[model samples]
Each structure stands twice: as C-alpha cells, then as structure tokens.
Target: MCSHTCAPSTLLQRDSISKCSLCLCTWLNPRRWLNLQEYQSKKLMQDSGVAVQRFYVAHTASEALEAAKRLKAKEIVLKAQILAGGRGKGVFDSGLKGGVHLIKDPAVVGELAKKMLGFNLTTKQTPKEGVKVKTVMVAEALDISRETYFAILMDRACNGPVMVGSPQGGMDIEEVAASNPELIFKEVIDIFKGVQDDQALRMAANLGFKGPLQRQAADQIKRLYDLFLKVDATQVEVNPFGETPEGQVVCFDAKINFDDNAEFRQKSVFAMDDMSESDPTEMEAAKWDLKYIGMDGNIACFVNGAGLAMATCDIIDLHGGKPANFLDLGGGVKERQVYEAFKLLTADPKVEAILVNIFGGIVNCAIIANGITKACRELELKVPLVVRLEGTNVHEAKRILTESGLPITAAEDLDDAAKKAVAAIRK
Candidate 1:
C-alpha cells in the first residue's frame, strides 16, 4: 500500500511489516516527526563529509553581523532558523517580507537580523500564529549551475531503505511526484550491504550529473547515507543538492528526521531537539509518557489506545463535534496518570466537554473510574464529562462512578458517548 516501490525483506515475513512501514506512511502523510533545524541538519551533513556552504549560527543581531563578516563572502545568505518549510516565501509578524534574505553588504546583516530574530515567522507549513525565530544561519551564497533532488528514506514498499533522486529540484518534490512521475527515480538499497557504489552512481546519473561532477555527487550521496545510518535517521532530504558554477557539488539545503524508536541509543542526537518550537501542552504530556497532539476542536478525548483514540475523534466529528486533542494513555495506565490526563483536559480553555473512551485490555476499568472521580473533585472540573467503559471490571468501574454522586453522564457505547459529549457542548 506504500507509494514507493515494493520489495520484500529477509527480516520481515510476507504477512507482517515493521514499524519503519508506519514511519514511511507518516512521512508521506506529512505528520510532525522528530526533525532538526536546517542548521543542525547541515551540521550533520558537513561532519559526515557532505560538501555544504560554510555557515555560522547567530542568536543576536551583533552575532549575525559577525557571522556574515566571518564568512567573508561577497554575497551572504541569512536564513531565519525556524523548523517549518516554505521559509523563503514566509512573512514575519514585523512586516518583514521573507524569512530568508541574500545580503549584498555584510554591514547591513545586523539590520536584517534585527527584523528577523524574536519575530514570529508564519509559513505555509506553520500555524497562523507562527513559530518565533530565535536563531539564524549566516552562510556564504553560492552561484549554482544546476539543482537536483536527493533523499534517503525508510520505505515500507522496499521493506527497508530507499534512495530517491530527481533531476528536478529546488521546488516541491511532491508536485513533481504527482505531475512528472518519471522524473522521480528510486533505488532500493540492500540494508545489510548498505548503499552500493553502483547504486550511488546510478542515482547521481539520474540526477543529471555528468563527467567528474557525477563522481562528486555519488561520493556525496554515499556520505549522506553514512550519516543517515549513523544517526538512525528515518529520512534525509536535500533539496537543490546543487553544483556550483565552478563545477563543485554541494548540499544547498537539507532536512533530516530521526527515528523515535532509536532515541534510547541515539541520545546525543535526540538531545538536539528544540522543545520551544513544539506545543507546550504536548511537551507536558511527554513528561508523563503520554502521546498527545493538540487540535482545533472543543471536545477533548482521552483513550487507552491509539486506534481507539482516532476512532473517538472521528465519531465525535460524525456527531457534529470537534476534538480539541488526541491523548492516548496506552496500556497499564496508573490511576494518577488518569487524574493527570483529566487535569490536562480541563486545563484547556477550548475544551467545553471531555470524552473518556477506554477499552480495558491490559488496563483496569476501576482505576480509570477512581481517577475520574478524584479528578472531578480535586480539579473541580467545570466541563461536562462523558464516560464510556468496557472490557475488564466494567461493572465495578460503573458502580464506582454511580456511587460518586457526580454530574457525570454514563454512556452504553462509544456512539452514545460521542452523542452525549456533542449534546453537552450544545447545551
């Protein structure tokens, strides 16, 4: 079902796939994964021997000016370091036209940096409020002769890693994939053997590099793959992996995503995460080892499993209600965690009603019931609450809720729960 080419892996059975499959799925769907800023990604690339323009990171106007002067280039490029894409076309809250600018004079770099730093930059990939720019990358500008696309990604279709490249670059690769599919080329890599020399050469050739330039591009591609494996990366993409007018190949811009599963072993890489760019509520949820994503709706949902959590949101929408957040408690949740979950839900001003949908497999329904009662009393919950419990010890949980003398509405099923949650909001 993956969009990329299909290939079987020795590690996986024909009937079963690995988590990397879901990784690839989320990548195609454009979900928010653990990714680094451009400066961080390019730093990894440069350390791994991938040719890139010399750059310096600046946190202040004076630092920006110093960085530009340090680059000592005739023309310097100042890029506001935000996590979002489309930054070149993005506008800052200060009325600045672009997040990226090419400075002809190094002295004026401080002025532009003043307009960028501490300002919120809204791009197509960011929310309307936008993310604040705290840092900038001042780098030497290049005279590029040809631009090309290159990427290494975990592919479900390949059952492992895949190298993707294209002659078309510096634009939305998704549009190219949709329009001119032939321009997109793919090489399924042997995971054990790694990216073969021939595989690298073929990808470089496909990107339209010729003569000595092709060899340089191939070497860069190999180094990128080494970096990918070194960091346990799920995806590494270079847009406009370009050739200079002087016949030098360099990575113009890049984005890298690391596998969340590898955080245990890749601690150093994970530590580089910029939490300021993330939602405050989501970060709070992470402290409790909970999976939560904030949404734009008014109904907050707390479910035991990811699949059921999604279903709860869908059914809420089906009943003319919108979900404010997706909070998955997973299995074996503690009573305190449940209480904390309710605290989070009630804390959201947008949440007019709360929906608790739990299927007790490894979880005990009584723990959830006790947590709910404690949360309502301790937090003095103001929002209407709807509860739908099933699986283990369901009767004991229902009895506890009934004896609590709370204003909680008990539902017979998920459908009833969603309807009640929506009706509670309307009232």
Candidate 2:
C-alpha cells in the first residue's frame, strides 16, 4: 500500500571517509517533502480534467451518514482520511477495526464511521502508534474492469525524468518490478520536448489499452505531464488507473509529491494541507530553512549539511550514543539560526545532552559562537553540550567560546565530540 512514491537522490560528498554505511540525499530536501492525502490527490487530478469517482468528506459519524444518504447509491466505500496506506487491512491499537469498509446499506455507513472516527489506526505504513482519523470519505462504488499502474518520476540512474507503467496494478509495484522486470514499461522523456505523444501511446499500449482509448490514455499522460511540471511535482502516480466497461478511463487512486524548495510557486497545493497541522519541530525548522527529524535518544546531534548530519549520527552510534535528532543547518549559518536550533534542543526533555558539530564553509564560526552564548544565557540549558568547529574562522570561534565563561566542552574533531557527548549522557 505505497502512497507517495519517489526514490531520493544519493548525496555526493567531497573528500570524506567513514566506515559507517550511511546514505545521504541532499537533492530531495527532507524538510520539503510534502505528501498529499488520497482525497486531496484526487481533487488535484480532477482539476486537470482527469475523471475521478464522486466522493464527499465527513468529519463526524452523523456527517458521514448524511453524506452517504445523499449519494443514494446501492453500495459505497468508506475510507478513513489518514495520511497512511494499507488502511483497508490495517488494525487499530484500540481494536477499533478496519480503516476501509464497503457497505451495501447506507445505514451501515454511520455504524462503521462511529468505529473509525476519533480512532488512531496503526497501519504497516504509519508510525507505531498510527495517525488519528478525524475524517472519513464516502465514495460511490465504481465498476472498474482493469487496473493499471502509471507514474512519472525522476530516475536517479538516468538522472532525468522517466514514466513507468505496468498492466499490473493495486499490488506492490516494486515487487512486481523486481520479480517481473520485463513486465514494467519505461519511457524516458526528452527534457526539451517533454513526454511525446508516441511515448504516451507506447505506455497506453503496454497497459493493454486499445482503440480510441489509446488516444484518450495518451492525452491523460500529456495532461498529467503538464500538471506535474506546473505544480513542481517530483512524482505523479495514478495506481490502478481503471478502465470501465464503457471504454472510458478514470483514476481510481492518485498521488502527487512536490519539491519543497519550489513550494513558493505551489502555494495553493501546499495550502491544501495546513502547516499548523504538521509536527511543530518540523514546521519550526522549515521557518529557518533547516532540516530536522526527531529521534528517541538523549544525545542531540546538530551539524551542517545532510551528509555531515548522517556521518555525525553514525559516529554517535559508533561511540555508543544514540542521536536524539538529525538537525542540519544549511550553508551560510547565521547567529539567529544557531540560537534557534539550540533553543529547540533545550525544549526537548528527551535531550539529555547536546553535540554541536559545525563545518563553517560560508558559515562563520564567529556568528555560531555568539549564538551559543546568547542561547546558553537565554535558555539556561543545564545539560552538557559538546562543540566541534572546523573551517572558516575556527580559531576565532574557539577563542569566543573559551572566554564566554560557559561550562561547554570543546572537542577537537568528530570522534572527540561523540565521545564527550556520550560521556555526558552516561553520567
């Protein structure tokens, strides 16, 4: 039940050596990864003239029942509006039952919605505790005859855009691609020309489409391509792009992912999903253009660059210290950003100690030093923090920290920093 599908690009490093097998990706900025819900994806596709099943969203059981009654269909599918997959077969920790249900009678919609609403459902794709389903969607049942997988994404191997599709859909396409590699069809698009009509026809023919539907299917691909670039989408997926008995094609499911860096242009699509509803720390990091993801460890490791962050985490684990979080301050660091990162670390009770690993390229160590002093006095962080500074005014940075009269321990290198931070938490 894969929803958002995109292979992150591998990060390249200059003159770095470590035994730790850590994979880093600076291309797909972690802070910018935006995943739209199923209903939301459908709406975006519908706007592009793609046919989709009619549905209505309900935030309460009464609303759900009312929405179903309005549909007046003989059968309906009630889907939980959570940002996770495998909902149809997922189980809730509270034993609330299924995330998706099909009811023959409209009366059953209220009964099922009662059990699903306000319940946190743990799916194979969600967190261990699962996401809460505050709303549910009731859609009219469709007579889908054929299910096919269709997607356009950036191929890391090709280093360009590629459209992938297969007649096999509604199953793990990855597994299918692995077991039956020949079954999958790929069309590498020309950067200047975009996805050509011939390529779309090939994709349609590969998906078993024939007659006038082939032309319709090709037009669908063209429209999807236009939408993809227009919205700055990294990946556009329509799994089980269904073919009806009437020789018409409709998207049974849709998924669209946009690059966070280009979010300024795609504000409308992003505004569809509220930023306030996102994780507080993640949203806060976005405000400062920092990349952050929390973990369940005591040693909070802060560093510059994505590759360095991964390396820091590896070194911390090597030194028997688990990282509390991965926080990367992008190039050209400012004192305010440094203070903000430290302030965030202080707010986390799980953070027993802090490790500041800064590689000042365009980032001046002097500003970092000032930020540390300001953050220390303002937050009054009682926990031990190990600081490691390298490149661009390193000596000046050390002098500022040494004379600041703080209890912070200074490390010579990454290994030294990890050892000191681990020692602080152990005590």
Candidate 3:
C-alpha cells in the first residue's frame, strides 16, 4: 500500500478478480509520482499565483545565513531540504534536535545549517538510514490565525481529478482521514470542465473559511488546480494553508509530485530532480530502462513483464524463499539489458541464488540465453543459477545454454523454478 496522504479508493472492479493482483496493487499504490523538495514546490506555487511565504534556497551554511539576512524578518525558519515529510519532528545524525528550527537571531542560522547540511536526517517517512540534507530553505516564519489542509489529486474513484480539504491542518492527512473521515471533504472535478467556481466556493466554505477569506481560499484553489494541470502534476498538497495574524491567506508548506509520463514536456520541472536522493542501484537500472527494486531476501528474480516479476516474487515467497529484488526486463529487451540486469543481481551481497523467468512474447529467449552465458563466463558468477525459459525460441535458448556447459540448473515450469532456486540457496 502507498503511504501518500491521498485517501485510498477502490481502483479495480470487483468482477476483475481474475486479473493479476500485481496490476491491481500497482494501481492502488499512488506513490509512483516524482516528488520535489519543499522549496521547489513553494516556488512553483508562488509562480502559479498562489500566495506563499517568502523563501530562499541555499546549498551552503554561509548561503543560508545570507538568505536569512536578506529576508530581514524578525523571525526566520530554517528547514532541511529532504524529499520526505515529518521534517519538523526529524532528528539529525549530529544529535541536532530537529530538521526544522525557528531562530530569533539571523546570526545563528548558519550554525544550524552547518549541523543540517551533509548530515543524515531521519524522519518517520524516511528509511532508518535517513536521507542526507544537502540543501536548506530559509524563509519567513508565519504567525497563523488558523490552519487548513488542501490538495488536488488524480482520483481513481472519480475517474478524474478531485480536490480534498480539511480545517484540521498541520497534521497527517491520512491519520485525519482514518480517525475522523467525516472531517475530510472531497469535490470531484470533471476532467473536461475542470474545477468549477461553485465547486471551489463550496469546498472553501466547507473548510470553515468565511466571507472574504472563503473567496480568497476559493481563488487559491482554482489557481492550484491550474498549476496541477499546467505542470502535469499528480498531486499538489498544501498543508497549513493558513490565515495569518494580518488576515492574509498563504500557503505555508507545500508538496508536489509530477507525472513521470510528462517528463518530456515538463523538462524544466523534471530537471529539478535531485538524483542524490535516489537509490544508486535503482538509478543505474534506470539508465538501462530496467525496472529494479531492492528487497530484503536471498533469491534474485529476473522476469519479463511487471505482472510476471511480481508473480515470481510471490511464488518464491510461497515456497519459503524471499526475493532479493524485483528486476523486470520489460518487453523488447536486448542482450545487453539482460547482461546488465544480471550484473545488478550478482552485485547484491544478499543474493545467494538467481532465477530467470521469461515468457517471451515480444522478447527473444535466445537473447536472454546469450546474455546469461556471456555474463556467467565473463563475470565469473559464483551464485547458483536457475533458468526457466518459455515461449518464442525457447528450444533454441535451451540448446544454447546446454551447449555452453554452464553450471545452470533448468526448471520445467515456474513452480519448479521457484522450488529449485529456494532449495539451491538452502543447500
């Protein structure tokens, strides 16, 4: 299940039970969006005509201090720039109390940034190893009179877009949805017509804003929706969409995720991607157009399609074997890709055995066989290897493997392949 703030909705039809559970699970998980850091999200919102706090991004401690000086606010806030949430409560490896801080004196901003920059910040949303903070955001701290939650997301239930809001802001929206589902308000928008003015107004009022403030929030909602469409965003979340002591409405914190499919057209937005936050192996796999996800298991899996990859993992687990990774050699795979995928699998110290499950529809089993033999010889692969090839030139593939005389065990079917791989590892 995805940990995104969006409320979960039924994405598959009940009659489609015969469909692959992997496909159904993929649709249900909404964490596929490309996430941007807080400062980047705020900049996008500010540019989209949505009111946001004044802020500056800095890569160094000196720059952080300079940004705080330039703001000249009586009080300033320093935030560690990591992709994950729960930064306010996150702790730094340096024993620093929190990733976020409010300082009365601008002079101390640099000290805090020194503690944050280059240090790992562990948050509930992040892995235990945590993500390193290479950047910091220095912004004017707001004195809020009220707080609210607002977001625009592509909803499967609506079969289009939906606006979600709540007066209970500055809290986990998922927790809010679970504990008090009635407090959350949703307005489904027709993809063709967009968010209507009446709908915005109704949502704004439902968020507990009144009079001019309601209209102002409504206007902000429309602007957010426009930005969502403009940037091809999958989500635009503004938590603590707040009213200040001065009666002005502003977006205090924001998070935005773009659709990966739109990266070509949204070049500028996609360029902001910080590769440092990504898994090194996953990044390497991306270079070869291979889909790889690491897991905590001993058997490495290589399959052709997404559904088949997942099914392979399931079968391995069912046989009391855990998968070390999910490596999907998507359709039209080349020999080089197969070799590269093998390299990634063997590189993992956890992988004691490897399984190749290919039901070649558009892929050539011969290519996979050639790549495997090439890798086994050149790379001196020490792990036990199990091969299961089906469809399209599988006979030729088998002949090649057999003639190569490699120490590879052949399986008759998926179940046999999974069992052999598991038994080999245990031995």
Candidate 4:
C-alpha cells in the first residue's frame, strides 16, 4: 500500500481497498475514529467552508516571522505542531500572551519561535517535545462574548459516541466540572441510527442555546459529529469554542488525539503525526520496540512487567519520592533488553538514582541482576542503583549485584528498597 516504486494502478487499488476497510471499522469507536493534527483540523474546517483565521505555515523561525509580518492582523500564534494539550499553559510560552503573540514588532517573532520550538513541555500525561515551529499561523484575534467547550467523544456510559457541550469553556473545563457540574450538557448519538434533527434542537434548547448563535452552535455540533463519523476520529475538542461578536461560532483552538491502529485505512490521518513534539528518548524507545517513558523523579526505575513497573513507581511515590522514568524490561526479558533499558535511564539528565525492581516471576532475578552488572560495566553508570530482588533466583541475583562492586544497594523487600532509593536520592 505504501507506493514508493509500485505501479500507479496497483497503488490506487490498494489505497481504495484500505479506505473501505477503515470506514467499516468506524463503528468500532465512532467517537474516537479519526485523530487529526491541528493543521489537518484547520484544513478540514477550510474544506467545510467554516470561517476560520487566515494562517500560514512556516517550517523555520524566520519563515514564521515572515508570515506574521505579512498577515493583516498583528496577532499570531506560533504553535509547535505536536498533538498535545495545554500548549498555552506555558510549556514554552516564551512570553507569548495567551498562546497568541501580538506581532506589534516582527523582529521578536523569530527569536520567540526559535526558543519555543524544540523545547520540552512536561504535562501530567506526558513530556512532549515542544512542537518545532515548522509553521507559525498568523491570524486575526477575535473578541468573544463567551468561550465554551464542544467535543464529540466515545461515551462509555451510553455504549456509543456522544457530543458534549458546555457553555463554560476555556482551559478550566475541569475546574468547571468540579465546581459546577450542572452547566454541562451531553447528547449521545448512535452512528448507525444517525442523529435526529429533533435531538439537535432539544440539545440546543437544554443548553439555553438561543438566537442565531445557538442555532449556529447546534449546526456546528451536528457537522462536527458528521466529520467524526466520516473520518473515524478518536477525540475532537474545540476548547473555548467561541461566539465571536459577529455572531459566528468559531473553534478558536482544537485538540485531537487519534488511535494509531486506524492508521492502516486513514492515510491522511497517519500523515498528521508531528515528530517535533515527541521526546527523543521516547522516539528512540519506539525505534527499539521498548515501552519507555520519562518522568520527573530522581529515581530511574526499571521493572519487568508494565503493571509491576507502574506499581514500582507508585511505591516510590508512596515513599515520598518521584520516579525518573518508567522503563519496562518486559516479560521474558534478556540481558540485551535489560542493558538497553539501563542505558536509556542513565541517558536522562533528570535521573539522579536508579531502582531495579525485578519480581522474577516469569523472568529470573539472576538474569536481571546479571544484566544490571553488564549494563553497569558497559555504561560505567555513576548513579546509585537500588535493587529489590525476589521470587526466582533471589539469592543468585543478590550475589551477582554484590559482587559487581557497583554502587548498588540490594533490598529483600519492596518497602526497604523504596526507602533506600529515597534515602540515596536525598543524599
């Protein structure tokens, strides 16, 4: 299906077949079908004849500034092209106001762009690479009567996808949910059954949606759901979905997250991946087929299973310490995997100490300890390694670690190991 050198006819046939298969799977998760990039979402909006901001894409900082200079509006948004949320929360604000830069002077745009692009934004969910300023979008800022949230997501409660609307929008939707839950309204849709016009009317009515603006919101919601089904989108959110002074309902900003499995049929969807926003270590881990993620703790943790790896991190937190990274050595892991995991952990500057917790259920502790010993020798790890070995070959594991003469503290239990790791980090 990837037509680098294939015949044109064969490529077209394969592409068509792939599209059909993906469309069939849209029902698999109607709400969470197509995961689109910001650029793609903008493109989709343009295709739908929505009134959106005029924008330009610049791959470099200079180009972004140039685009800003050309725009009629002095305001520009230099977005790092990664698909992550809370970009305006100052992951790399670079003194940009509300994620929108008032380009009063074009001279500062390039400097801001260069600094924000390729920076690191650590969110609670993931540490994303600041979207490289491949393209800066320069647009007119709008004055809004109100900001609201509009999203169509798979509703587990309804056993189908649903459109959720809130009069209260912006970055603080979570706060709104916590403080006032009644303000939010939801409408579930059975994609196969299709959405009824009356249902849209009622939803609009319940939300106190009135006047021309209300009708527009209702229509936009309907159209958004249609796009969701058509594109097989996973999550589509327009936060602070605006009611501008001109009676136009505009999605001032969009955040979309997609399912990778659907990439087979959604060729355009897959093209949305922006590598500029991904961490180098994570990218490298993906390349090596490893499940690894960086964290903000001082203790670099390496465990055998995903569940156990998480438990280890929790225990570390329970003991009043943070985990530097989550590195799962995996079940039935070998010396090579262990060695690579260790290398990845030490590579992180945030990691001040290392914790090797091996349950050795399906994986023998001795193998893990041997890997640790091997990894230490090869990498000459300067950080302290606090290891807890149990289950299979526990004694052998301890012997290997102790004999290595590396800066390793071996514990017989989780509690003791966690304490030691915390103590080591504090020291």
Encode model 3's per-residue lDDT on 75-144: one tens digit a residue: 9999999977779899999989799999989999999999999999999878898999999999998899
TM-score of each: 0.90, 0.87, 0.90, 0.69
Tell me the whole-model lDDT of each prediction, alpha carbons only: 0.85, 0.80, 0.85, 0.67
Please give the TM-score that candidate 4 achieves against the real structure.
0.69
Which segments of model 2 are wrong by more than 4 Å? 1-28, 91-95, 127-129, 156-159
Clashing residue pairs found in predicted model 1: none
- The residue-level lDDT of candidate 4 at 325 comes to 85
Model 1 lDDT tens row, 65-129 = 99998889989999999878789999999999899999889999999999999999999989899
lDDT of 4 by residue, 300-384 (tens): 8887666677678779999999988867666667788788888889988998888888887888888888888999999998988
Rank by TM-score, descending?
1, 3, 2, 4
**What RMSD value applies to candidate 2?**
4.8
The positional error of residue 87 in candidate 2, measured at the CA in angstroms, is: 1.8
Backbone clash total for model 1 is 0
Q: Pairing residues by index, what is the TM-score of model 1?
A: 0.90
